[model samples]
Target: MKIITLIRGTIRELAAKATLYVLAGISTLMLLAAALAVGADSTPDGKTITFFGKQASPPVTNEMLADLAGKLEAGFAGGLFLGIVVFGVFGTAGVIPDALEKGTVDLYLSKPIARWQLLLGKYFGSVAVIFLNIIYFIGGLWLIVGLKVGVWNGRFLLSALLLTYVFASLYSVVTFFGVLSRNMAIAIIAGILYLLLVAGPLDSRQAGLYLISENGIYRGILDGLFYIFPQIPAMESGAMHIIAGEHAEAAPYAQSFLSSGGILALSAWILHKKDF
Candidate 1:
């Protein structure tokens, strides 16, 4: 019950700060643009695609609509995933650091709540904020594409959950760094650098690294780091596969989930032991 109260309080605090409005405004604009830009006309023989009423080159056959729809869905899902990750990180990075401020921590600790519970509540409150925006943005996009493009791909909706999980995974790193350094800038930079540099580049260049280095120790360390960090690239690829209605591997999701769990647990432990 205390945790629930803390979660609600966090949500209310965030809402009061207009974070929800900012995110929702961006989502609404995207949906509006999609609605205005996309159009489809169907006949007995085939379908004609249009952008702003200009006919797309080479009319699409009825048989190709499914393939085209799948591609469109995947493309939109990918864009949303990227946007949410970037924006979610920037928006919520301050959550933990702000909570850990001198007076704020003192006031929070004065309550009957356990330190871990307080940290978990703040963590989940941030997640809930992102979750709601994901639903709003993804759901609005789904509706726009379904109604305008004449393709109601249900699989695209699942991307919302997958994207939320991805954010949660990355946000765990932000939370860890936030707890460690008590600096919002550090938290934000850690999440962004991990996404852009560590996760994407390292995952893609693993084979190249192995080729460049003959040292067994180097190779072993590389492989160990690969398993230690959240498997973001693999998980992202799996998300795209799922969006495209293909079989997605489970290992990436499992690896990421475990790494994120471990990181969050460590953050909570650190918070518990920290001198307020």
Candidate 2:
């Protein structure tokens, strides 16, 4: 009951700030633009596609249509994956630091709830915020593309869950830094930098780095760091594969899930021991 209350309070607090409204507005605009810009006509022969009322090309064959649908879904999924990661991190980065504020922490600690419960509430609450927006954005896109373009790609909807998982993993880092630093900027920066610099570059360049480096010690260290961080690129490519209706590797997602769980546990332990 206490955790549920906290989650509700967190949602109400964030909603009051217009965060949810702003995200929803962006989603609505995207959906509206897609509806206006994308059009298709199917005749007895083939299908014709248009953008902004301008014909994209001559009528395309059924095979071409299938290829186009796969590319379209994959493109949207990739773009949304990146967009959600950036905006989601910025949106929820302040939750922990704000909660750690002097009077705020005092009020929360005064309750009979355990510290881990408090942390979990904040963590889940922030995730809930992003989860709602993700569904809105991805679901809107799915509907628009399916209804307007005559392409019903059910696998595309999986991007919503994939995007949420990525954000949750990233948020664990944000929450850990927020609790440790009690500064929103540090928390936000840490999450973004980890995504851009650490996880992204390492995952992309790991093979090349291993090939170039002769030092066994250096290679071992790189391998250790590789396993330590979330395999975002792998997860991303896996998501693309899934969106394209192909088989995706499961190891990256599994490793990322474990890494996120470990980080969250560490954050809870730190919060439990820290003096308010």
Task: Give the TM-scores of the predictions, in the order they appear.
Answer: 0.93, 0.92
Tell me, by lDDT, which candidate is best: 1
Report every candidate's CA lDDT. Answer: 0.83, 0.82
Off by over 4 Å in 2: 43-45, 61-64
In candidate 1, which residue ranges exceed 4 Å CA deviation? 18-20, 61-63
For model 1, residues 13-120, the per-residue Cα lDDT tens digits are 777766567777888898888789878887565787777888763467755775676777677777777777777777888889999999999999898989889888
Estimate candidate 1's alpha-carbon lDDT, on a 0 to 1 scale.
0.83
lDDT score for residue 136 of model 2: 85
Writing each residue's lDDT as its tens digit, candidate 2 over 136-224 gives 87788778877887777777887778878878888888999998999999999999899888887678665577777789898888778
Q: Give the per-residue Cα lDDT of candidate 2 at 18.
A: 64
lDDT for position 5 in model 1: 87
Backbone clash numbers for all candidates listed: 0, 0
